[model samples]
Target chain A: MTNRRKFLRNLLSVTVALGLSKKLFPNLIAFDDYFDDDEFIIRNGWVLLKSDLDSTNDY
Target chain B: MIIDLDTATKNVKTADYDVCICGAGAAGITLAVYLARAGKKVALLEAGGFEYSDQSYDCYKGKNTGMEYWGLDTCRLRYLGGTTNHWSGRCKPLDEVDFMERDFFELPGWPIQKSDLANYEAEAKSVVDISGDFTAADISNWTSGKFIPDRYAISAPTRFGDKYRAEIEVSGNISLFINANLIDVRLNKELSSVTELVVMDYGKKRFTFTGKNIVIALGAIENARMLLNCDTQLKGGIGNQSDFVGRCFMEHYNINYGFFSGNPKYWKNMKKGLSLYTDSQFSLEHKIGNGNVSMSISPDPPTGGGRSKELRKYIRNNVCKWDEITELSRKFVDFQCPGDGILGTLMEQSPNKNSRVSLDKETDSFGLRRVNLSWQMNELDKRTIRTIGIELAKEFARQDYGRVQLASYILDENAKIPVGYHCHSIGTTRMSKSPEYGVVDKDCKVFGIDNLYIGGSSVFSTGGGTNPTFTIVELALRLAKHLS
Candidate 1:
């Protein structure tokens, strides 16, 4: 996987793995480079899955 | 009485005094007030007039080729009040750990201890117009091992000009000269003591003032420029013996590390550590670094309208719903916090030899070489910030306060480090026990020059993360007593 994608996957995994850790996402999205991206948007506790993905949530 | 050098008819003249102080800023004024009260004659030479003039401030303009910084002329004010005219008034004493020599930092120790300056600090609080009470109730056990109880006191940030103008006018012993810019320090043939201070005002009118003793109370950058420019008797500068005059420039590397929020109970525990006069502080036991790092948290909930208000209320009111918590987290997900608080870090840097101020060929209108400041950070600095941040993040998670998201820039080695000088310039003329290690000796006197001494943050051996004004006043008060 690409570095950006790999980074996003790891970030999402860490966010979930830590049981909705609040600090991680705030700091991650604080960066202007990733602030505009919509893939991480969450609605009703479910993250909007990024495109170009298979059914399984595996990197 | 305040004499305007610009208007004085007897411009080309010589005067004698017991003490000659350069730079009518915090240190100079503090020392003058104390010494004058003790019935000593003092000659206080201020470069600028009572108010700031463009021509006077232009002298501070310089070049910066090292780290990004505020223009040299911008950070410090060059008037009667000095930089205190624009000070933020945050006050905190240096921790005990800051005065000790740590193996992790180079030249990381002071010749004196906190106790040595304790009495002076008590007096300094009155000078800075802050409440003397600096006590804090520890709540570290609330998070078990997550935080240490650290606190800070606020200052009125006494402006020396407005606050002491009446006292200076009434003091019969102090000859306050406005616009009397110090141009040269003529030493005796042996170069042992400063014999005269050659000052010039606008219109090229010159005046000579001699004193039994001389104290350079100019701020860090100007102090180095003045010393480096005094190359008539000495090759490099006065007190440049051992080549330590302008080395080891230090400043607090302040940055927004990350943001985090705690549950209502967690917030309550944290709130107990903060007050109007004193605010939150943290320290780590068994730390690997030489300097103690202090971090402060600000509650920056969303602004604008009822949406932000509702969002905050929902996050504070609903703790159990995973969906609401995720939505609450998303608000702050992209640098925009829709949450309870924000976290910032103000870290101390180990003294680095390469970080220094040097003379450039470029001269200001006064023909004095402008100071070229080289501000560089070391690996220890980066490592300390990252390590402390990660440790804090882990502790919060373990204690269920909330997760900490460190700024991506802090984690990225190649990311352009954000640039913002806290206006706390320090350590150019660092103090030490011997000449080999520093520019000034134990009593704040220059190494080889007998009667020449230094006052201000320039004499700091280590630039602790705490704001420097409080310590500057404390040291100035101490130096006044020593001189008397």
Candidate 2:
């Protein structure tokens, strides 16, 4: 637990941690709660969990 | 690795190097370390720096030594670590499914399989520090039924250059540079052999690096872009017959953001398992019917879904409002998704000749033409993504374990759209059995060109719907051992 926490702290600075953290924490993480109200998707990469799975930009 | 006067000359330096490599990113550096460890002279030429030495390939990724040059979510770095510097380090091996030639799709499987690259993967594990024993049979045995307890897991993703930085630096035969950038590759009059590698510094100081053997470790787009730029002697570009040089460009396609509710606590699974499996690749085992696929699963919520049921209840009942009930329920939904986070792919397009990178009139920091990326998704790719999306939703629904929802397609074109760009791409200089079909041969040697080799994801013949780092490192190590 101690080691995992340290790893998480390091990972949070980068975006990969968002997905990785959710994977590690499962139900414990709420994306809405992690950041402040000022936070928007522009400065942050969205967790695209339900909106874009069907659309594609291949062309 | 000095920016001496002869550098602008390309491939005819006075230094004594047993091997001279171009593009000092992941594969080039790995090969450099191997040659050095084996007591051979090695000189590496990089087009960028330890991430910031040259501004051309910077992806705005702040330095984390080993991860300094990790490939970013939407950009490529022409810097020291190659693309691995910015990579998410989510390593997984290419499986038998990824290796099988999909007759259903116009693709050819690799001559080797999960078994062929095992030893290299072992070495890769060491190169990038991570835990977990990656074995093919272990993954194969996962679904064998009664005797097998579903211990199905995957590969450990580790950043290669960061993991092996110290080893590369201390080696006796390896030499690395921070500011070196490949400008032009001077070839012989025959236009078949690479005689000199012309490099330039941020100061415009030209350098020409020469060696008996040379390698191109530049990433997929840059590899082809560089070749196409070297049109001084070769018409139609070097090794560009059949217009194959910039053809068949591909990448893994991943479109996320679909919802899946009704799983009660399915959110928990996606979060906890992100770090659970450390195999070579992630696939659903039976994803081929929809046209060659690989997968990973995760909960819809962030920070993992372990306490999802509890958190959802707290947010819904205790936090505040009856009006926000729908929003809270949306949070409780059990949708799961995984992607190459930075260049997170939800789909991988088949090799198409049209999707390519070509030179535009606009120049970059080094006065080179800005590489104009022409990425096009054919109907085949769109059809596959939609088909696979429905199929996967069905599987998640069929499991009786979770509900898979598809909504984005239900909206109008101008509605919330999802752009599935996995930028973890391959091809441009593909490998095939012969020169007629590829840029490199079985050993990653560019066809007809003796001593010129290409490693990294750039040489990939097909883009299986999975991250290519594990496979890239494995191939680098294979080249290392082969050259060692």
Candidate 3:
């Protein structure tokens, strides 16, 4: 029962990550490719890119 | 020198002036200063005193028949400084395309070009207390070709009554008359020129002053009311030969049409109070009127204890672990975030003859008929608002800069568009090249009457998307130069 639960948990995490990637970046192809380039990072289950975190002080 | 017509000696009536300007508003005050500097004797008549009085303000009371609107007495002030006392002081020149004749519009374009008024930019800025340059560079990184950054110069809102009172009081050429209401406009025997203006005081004391030239500088609504009320000589009124006097009333249509969720970087970089205007090319291509969009940042609102129903249901059905639920809550909180900004729109109302001011049977203390305003909007005006929303939404999505969720009313064709006015009354006695189309000529002179002229937003040929006060001062300066 413990092993089965671990497998299910991993499957759910991957499914949620893929769903979020598709919704946030529709133009992007393949979640692994974007992850490899470190274009997007998941924090608290929300996708946060470098551009989003950078401060835009110039007005 | 300043003279209180109510207490002034009767001999003051015998004085004839070079110019008799009605209504001591921005236009009238500017005209008086410039014309006096040119060494012309002037009589500047203000219906109200230096300050507000209920008796004087009561003259502005009227009826509104079409569309929801603020009361006539509420929309405008009747005192010496005029509406400038309560103006926002946002100044921007009319766009060049606003002066061009678009084939799609029903009305004729302005007879004068934007260049004609460009010469008075400095003087206008001085009169309104706008310092530094009037132009601002576009956003360096904005890639959207459909929208461009528009700048507005905030003025100190120089109140004409307060700022220029001392100047007019001490000037030898300008005779500032307080509490002098224009009651009649007597014409020459040939009915080709204005001979004299009959003014009345609060106590119904009447006085007449004759001038070589006469100008009605009352605000748009009152200007029309005065013209339509002076029907003693002509059946319709003075300068109403074309029957276009009091027609085509316009106001800036202001409303909130959508909400924007901008990308964090661009949204944070946007200057507070920034305004985006539809590109002139976009307007021409879309066959729509000019529009201005402004965004205000707002805090995001949370619903259902900070988690959406969908997220709560997903977590419950998935039987997610404690750590997973915490992460999902934070993600869902960000995902269902409220709009980052509320998009407000201000657009020009296309000129329509039915949107007008006419005289009502009800009479004021002076025994003159009151005004009955019927403000209307057409399909083009409605379409302009909807198109701005749709186009902005599309552009924001395409550029990946933001997302726009339009108001349901804008998407529905049959839904009534909730609109409000900017209190910028314009275009009752429009300027046209020919008398058949409009009441005033390019020089702002009444077509058949050589000496009668008008100075105010009432003479606007096309009410552009920007505020009208700056243009009013510019036109007054031009008229002063012409008269001098």
Candidate 4:
């Protein structure tokens, strides 16, 4: 559980940084590393699956 | 005249007072003064002396069965001024929406509307030493559409014992008795009215007084304790035939919910403790209770700002891998953030039947039962706090004002909520249109009991997000007029 959380937290930071910087630097980075999977995304702080995020639109 | 129960018991005549009020705190003193000015003879009783003492405060000791809470003896003051002796003096009246019934909440709303108490605002302000308009347009303009400014008027925080001591001493119609604890209440044969009030001092010296009307102005917990302890006449307690005397106990849910990184320019000009509340429409749309967030600007911004602090808190509380922590730290170094501020919240807790005050088996020095406070919160309350954080974060992001990083407990539904209270005990003797719903009526009179009234936050139908002193004074003023 601990390792899984760490992996998720690192993924969240990278994803959030990419998402935020995407508007300013659209082509600065390629989306191939982790964006291949469309199921997982970060909203606010939680790492949610697309279906779960849609159901619990907390924000 | 102020009389010490120790030496002056001989001078106190036990007959024919127009009004007898228990607990010479804010409500008791307020009611006494107003009724005295209206030409009514009043007997005002104080369980404690002019100052603090261990003997007096020991009565407040009680058990907490449901939730972790501040020690009851320490949360409230027992002296003549009551808890106002140590209050921070933040004052705001309940909002209009606080009185209306909402589909999301289960309890019955206030019997009286905000407009009904508007007539006493001026007098209440005078009593608390607050002047000028409570809300500022400039503060309201700073917020986006989702939130609006909510102002709290600072008071000299009038100590009723000190502020009204001279007036009470000079009043010919008002008799102030210090160290007089109300131990027992005797009702008529029909149990329709309180016939006599039996008071005792620390020495166990007893005295009895009779009045045409009686007002129980003890603070919230004590008021309920008093009613529940007077079981000699009524089985369940006086005016408790419906078993509503000590139910629906409430307190303003105070906690630090999130952190904000606000715009430096806007933050510099704003007051350090300015509050912003969720707009009424937003609250209704979100199906959440009313909420207020007070900003406390950090004197020195942390190395990584509010987000870093939030992440650090989360990491400290939850199990996280070292590699993920290092990556999160590296991301923070890459992203420069503005100054951070802490967001302290005061959210309204929905009234729950289980949150209540009951009589404990253990007796105090005077043989009166101690309060057993079971402070409970439901799913609605938890949701309200979480929704307020989410809404605030979204609003800040929308306006470019800042970003809000919510506390970890707010993000996880299964996490235990940190227990916090504002010491604003309320709703134990709630008012309603009828006895089937509450202990008191619209006039603060006990249901089914004539000439017996309640004054203070105990009669509050709902504990809004704001402090209760202003409303307590307003209700006392309204009750005084009704009694007169």
Candidate 5:
């Protein structure tokens, strides 16, 4: 029971650390909301997922 | 001195010279300058005086039975500068492969190799006022590794009359005759050497000009016409013993087909590399089709808010609202509007014997028989163009540079290809090693004749995919050197 509690505490600590980093370096996760915009994905030099080109999420 | 035979005395005395060049075009004028500099007494004769006139241009009128062409009289100007007065000044050397025979192209290859003209290219450049080197490496090094190293440059389009007239007027050994038309090329009793040239002035006065050597430096059509009409002595033609004088007509074919869209990131670099009139070449390997293709990229103009019919049609078809598409166009970089952007093409026509010029019953003002030009193309031309288009599209997709949308005509083999010409008529008096294949020999001398020679693109064995003026000047310089 103590080991389980320690693992949960460690996982929560990493999550909080990442959350704090989001405020300091926003560019890393800034595009998490635009997975639907093909132009935005292409503009950022990322390949378009097949699902992005299709409307029904075929891929 | 530049003298007009039209103003000469009624009984003009016959003049004798070392070298008499008939037709003062690019080739004749260039040869005149070279020979005169070597201290040879040169006589340069031009059909027209200083500028164009309707009477001089009337001799160019003829029939075009096969392809749609610009009016015969409208295509080549017959003034003192010849057709260079209207030249666009695009100059590129013939590629090495163009001088060799390829099985894919019909009757391909030149009797004289590119190395034969190599020594004279620099002088040809100076003559044409091409100030820059045509090495592709000298251009932008930023192309996406797809362009072949076959670059071209422009010229100031040095009109020989405007540029060399002052020197020709002052040169003591050179004489320039204006409004002197070559009426006949009379040969000796043995029919081996040219005896004299019968020249007619504008006022109907005829005079003889005898020389040690004579050169027919007229343009392609006129060269064939002059030879074919000289049947008074030779039954067929002067060099028509083998009947190859007016065979194998060729020209550079250009068509506006296809669109290419590029990424906005490399838009600036791409524009710099593929600017207007910049020669960027690409060739296909054996696996695909061994043909060369060149392209010129241009920007699309803005079309929005009822400004374009295409946008209106798209709106009606629900492709997109005009405002939405316009906004999208503004958002994307280097987005090519339909019918805009890069034009990829193959300009070299396959040499065809059936595409020829023959004498018609019609006669010009000079009493010479008119030319019946049959400008024809074949299935190979269509197949080559389609293959080039497919290869270009594949390359663009493979390199991730852009997307190519080919025009419907390029995709459909049965599509009626337009017969419009690029105004580069070539290969009427093609050069060959044997008289069986061509009219002129490797040295551009008529096969059977001893003293007569031909100049201009008429002697081109195969018209490579570039302007012929630069090659014409190079060959003229080489011929002058040989004669000297």
Candidate 6:
């Protein structure tokens, strides 16, 4: 299968599997990918649209 | 002369309304237009004042740009039109994969379809002035299109402050309240139905806005923070029984470091594209993923005279036409941001429970507790990046665009990723059909909080590879129909 087809197949299996289990998708858990590498740069660097609450006053 | 939540709720005029909207943004405005035109009594509450200030865009310049954000410590603002006043205006709809329930990652799709949103597409189109039905634009001369064999699309970057500001204020049925911030939700013990919403203005910080039904159109971060902060009523927080109130946060992961060969007509058009900065779109099909990878092009280093000159050594020698020569550089230019170009790139990040907002006892200047975000994305997020980067690079060579200089995923271990808002932060107070996984139901109502509804990008389940404003408007209209 093309990688695209494989991905589609994977998506279908998830639906079928989840449907078979019929259990709810697991809810969100806290996330923190503080890796020091750049491979996952996009993942770790997403700032909220207006993320100022976390800023400090010391500056 | 001071009115608190208790005093106002008790003594204020209790009026009935068909629908009450919140957040005055793309979603809120669409809901107001739909409901009020239908003769429904609708009140839209926004925290920021209207867009008539001299300092409106003065905040986006430099260090001050950080202050214009939403949080007290951040630079975004709180206002009638929400953060969109400063939004770069890139707009795209979530793709079908964004609606799929993918198992490869923690993200899940909504129990909805792209077709379900078909009715509102026209409305979204007319609002943004998108002329045609086809979202993708044609791009054939570019080398990237040679192998990828796909076209680019003309995306609409709707400036809400300019576009819908007057329409919302002038609408007879839509009562838009400026300087109104939703602080809390009052409800009975059953926790399913909410009674009254607690609000605050700038001075007193305690203003009461009562409604038969309430919609929280506050942006994503604030949406979760508002619900989580309303801890007085619910034990785990309103509609937060699963403790998912502030979890599953997602944003488009965007980074584009590539070179361009400067073609003047193409260069001029590319320069024009860059000047708008926040309003272009691209697609990257990830062979390994359920959702195809798409990119919103943002303003990168302009691909004019010198920048392309520096890249001539890397440029491919085969020249077809002089026009294609200048234009193809911006095409190969790695403006590979993951969102519409108005604000910046936003790539869909699969949800990770670790990426979340946790409340601290420390309050904002408004007495709201600070919500700390511990955002994270995993290797799956990189799977498409490497594939797309190589594929796009190959396209550059195939079309003889250049030896395209796209960035390598590998870099210094200590390198910090370039980050910016796509004007699309979603998934904090996610939408689910059931309470087990989300804060809001399919109709965008808080699962257990009866009178409370959420209308914003925050209700998105899986952050798709598109600009979110168009989808935000579509989803808000869908939620409104669920009520009337």
DockQ of 2: 0.02
**What tens digits encode model 1's per-residue C-alpha lDDT throughout B6-83?**
889885334778889999888999999888988888988889987879989888988887888878888998888788
Poorly placed runs, candidate 4 (over 4 Å): A1-59, B137-143, B301-339
Sorting all predicted structures by TM-score, with the top scorer first, yields 4, 3, 1, 5, 2, 6
Candidate 1: the clashing residue pairs are A23-B405
The Cα error of candidate 2 at residue B418, in Å, is 3.0
- Residue B202 miss distance in model 6 (angstroms): 2.3
| Residue runs of model 6 more than 4 Å from their true location after superposition | A1-59, B1-14, B51-75, B135-137, B141-157, B205-207, B260-345, B411-423
**Interface RMSD list for the candidates:** 10.9, 13.2, 10.7, 10.1, 13.6, 14.9
Task: Assess the local accuracy of residue B431 in candidate 6 as a C-alpha lDDT between 0 and 100.
Answer: 82
Model 5 TM-score on a 0 to 1 scale: 0.79
Best by DockQ: 4
- The best candidate by TM-score is 4
Better of 2 and 6 by TM-score: 2
TM-score, model 2 to reference = 0.69
TM-score for each model: 0.80, 0.69, 0.82, 0.83, 0.79, 0.68
Comparing 4 with 5 on lDDT, the higher-scoring candidate is 4
lDDT (tens digit, per residue) of candidate 2 on B1-484: 4333223444434366777777766677777876787777878776664544435544222221211122332367666676676676655666555566665455454556667788776677666665576423223313312111112223334445565567756765666655667777778877668888777766677766787777778778777877777777877666666566766777665555354433434333343221111122222333332222233343234333474756554653544344233323434453222221111123556766677766667666665655656666665665555555544444443433244334434122223334455558687787776666667777888776777778778788776655677677778888877776
lDDT score, candidate 2, position B454 = 80
True contacts kept of 6: 0.00
**Candidate 4 CAPRI-style tier:** incorrect
User: Alpha carbon lDDT of residue B401, candidate 2?
Assistant: 29
What are the runs in model 2 whose C-alpha is more than 4 Å off?
Answer: A1-59, B1-14, B58-74, B107-114, B135-161, B265-345, B408-417
